[model samples]
Target: MKKSLIAVNSVAGAALLTLVAGAAILLVLMFSTDGDADADRRAFFGSLMFSTKEQADGSTAITAGVDDPVPLIVLFVVLAIALTFIQLTYRALKVHRQRLLEERGLA
Candidate 1:
């Protein structure tokens, strides 16, 4: 039973790793600009608001939540941490079971 669980976990972990790698690649591609080095540098350089526009009367307007990623990336980061904790717990339990079997002389 323990061995089968470990096998299943290994398979699941591998699949998850692959999925994460693919998602990371996709994210990188998504954020990539059109061969503009200055733009790329400026993007991560500051947290300026993007909803501002200059009016013909020499005034500035600012709204909210334009290109905001905190609400989105926070979800991904929390879920990733949850998955890491679960995988670690699964591996720890598998090792504990193996040790128990070993101590019992059950191979």
Candidate 2:
């Protein structure tokens, strides 16, 4: 049972790490701007479904529908905290079980 619990925890941790890493990579990509003139400026906006184009002046003429990042950040933080709590709880449970076995002269 303990071995199975450890295996499950390992898999969960790996999956969480993969998700966090992917999100981090995506966030980095979102913030990164390449210094290429030929780079399609419309691509980014198009990905976000933005249809308005910039005028001769230096101001945005169109508003695009987009999801706010604040809520996503908050959700990620909450998930990270929850995963940490689960890991700590698993460790504590394993330790407690070991101590119990020792106390009963089973180990």
What digit string (tens of lDDT, one per residue) describes model 1 on residues 1-107?
76566556655665566446445544544355343232321122122122344567876554332144453344445555566667778789988999999999997
**Candidate 2 C-alpha lDDT tens digits along 1-107:** 76566556655665676456545544544445343221222222233322334466754454333334444445456665666667768789999999999999999
What TM-score quantifies how close candidate 1 is to the native fold? Answer: 0.39
Candidate lDDT (C-alpha), each: 0.51, 0.53
The residue-level lDDT of candidate 1 at 100 comes to 98
Among all windows of ten consecutive residues in candidate 1, which has the lowest summed lDDT? 40-49
Superposed on all Cα atoms, model 1 deviates from the true structure by an RMSD in Å of 11.3
lDDT of 1: 0.51
- Superposition error at 73 for model 2 (Å): 0.3
**Number of the top-ranking candidate, with lDDT as the measure:** 2
